[model samples]
Target: MPTDTVRYGMISTAKIGINAHIPAAVKSHNSEIVAICSRFDGPAKQAAEENGIGRWYGSYEELLADPDIDAVVNPLPNSMHHEWTIKAAEAGKHILCEKPIAVTMDEVREMTAAAEANGVLLVEAFTHRLNPHMRRARQLVGEGAVGDVRHFEAVLAFTSRDTSTDVRLKPELAGGGLWDAGCYSVSAARFILGGEPVRAAGFAADSGNYGVDTSFSGLLEFPGGAIAHMRSSVEQPGTNMGEVIGTKGKIRIPHLFEEDTPLVITNADGEERVETFAGEPRFVVQFNDFSECVLTGKAPEFPPEDGLANTAAVLALYASASSGQITAVERV
Candidate 1:
């Protein structure tokens, strides 16, 4: 609330916030993470102290009630996303929520509407889109670098050996490989295509223990017949990467969301080129961008509307697997 500061309060000292978000905020010129809230006080205080945050609250409500904090970042579970996001919006704080904004389309709509009605900026934290390479990739794709944009392919996977229970493996918590890693693939395809998917067909990986998907593979059809094939899994190990193939040429973005994106672009003239950003912390870009929107009252380029659209697509894919038929993605 001060003239020289953008005060942020994080709802949880989750792994993401501790390792990335908090540090990023500390490094940003315009932002300072002044408060932190967690269900348990230990991690909250520890993170706040380690990151040089000014205060730590024992509960989310306490952080939300802080008059000095201008923005709240929600890094809670997928199921908790809608609740906290709406709560933040209602409290008159701009929100930068983690993606897959909600597990269901209905909640996504409600959260989006709440942010709009409250006149507070709400943006899903799709850090990939904030990467300078992705920004340029979109521009090149639109300029016919990828010619008609016929198809796209993306994959996100990692191997976790932890036996400890996590929300990613819990259905009730909106956990699943699809809801977790799969959301990234879906969001990436949707981001590159620049439109909502009209339909989806997919298969879920049922490992028998969890009733939810452990892995998923799917195809999405965009408005102009542009199609995408995507795969995500928790039982696998690999780098996170994605590529967009258009009619004339294709672009490949390696280490897609992390810092220092190297973009390979090919044109119809049989020439290939690579572009790289100087180097930035991906999470820093996300925090700085969100802070700007909160301070200036500007709508986010990757707004809550994106959360709704991606949820619709992922939900449609789930439905297709459950019903054994192609399911239509509800337009956002």
Candidate 2:
């Protein structure tokens, strides 16, 4: 292995790992998927062979114990993210954990503290944040192209046919559309608005049998009078759209989360212009970003504190829904 390259051990053979992270890591010049792990031996062996990984481990502890592996991609279930991430950090393995970071802010703080104490990087894998288009949108907003940013609306929804057995449908596993998709909307709003929300109010519909939220709609109030509306549903047709409106102009992202897409900006003059970005797999970009931070000892663009802020906002939304009152977002 090259001294400049990061040898990665994948902690799970989950769909996201197999379909996105593995391929992304294989394509990254600074990253190598040296090993993959699954609790079951058969799946671990199959993933290793299918993904061209050098080795397979039936247990996560085995992969973590490997000295040659520099990092681990933790795409485990929501409930397992905190535990495994802490363990990975304790093992001196940099981690790219999946979104929402954790179901609660306390868990996020713990994971971040462990990583800091162990001298390992722990980044929340919000792939959309790595997209050039998203970065450009934020730049435009910050530059006042959308003057006096006042409002935002984002929706990310998808219909799930396998709700009965999907991990996303289990309450104990922290399954819900809000945690799965709504977090993206909330995080995007915070990013575009340039601050954390001060208050949040929302409503959620539960999956009767599972006691998990199938749909949620929320409103967040940021400092300086900026407001955002976010919606997510596991029972609706897929849609990904985000809009940021200001006094002078507005920006609309048709495919907010997708990698290759055009951003439409409309000004007060009723004139509109399109901004297009080079198509790059966001997962690949995310992995490369993590690799750069690991190699250079630089803090990640989206660090654990940002993850905690996002988690705090989401938790406030949940509290609002539960209490039927506007809930204050706890600052990290």
Prediction 2 TM-score vs. true: 0.97
- Candidate 2 structure lDDT: 0.90
Whole-model lDDT per candidate: 0.83, 0.90
TM of each candidate vs. truth: 0.94, 0.97
Best by lDDT: 2
Residue-pair clashes, model 1: 0
Tens digit of per-residue lDDT, candidate 2, span 1-332: 35678899999899999998888887897888899999989999998998789999999999999999999999998999999999999999999999879998889999999999999999888887667788889999989998998899999999888877888888888999899999999988988778889999999998566788899999999888888999999989999999999999999999887777889999999899999888678888887888988898878888899999999999999999999999999987
RMSD (Cα, Å) for all candidates, in order, is 1.8, 1.2
lDDT tens string, model 1, 97-197? 88778888788888888988988888878787777877787788777778788878888887656635776887777888888888888988877777789
Clashing pairs in 1: none
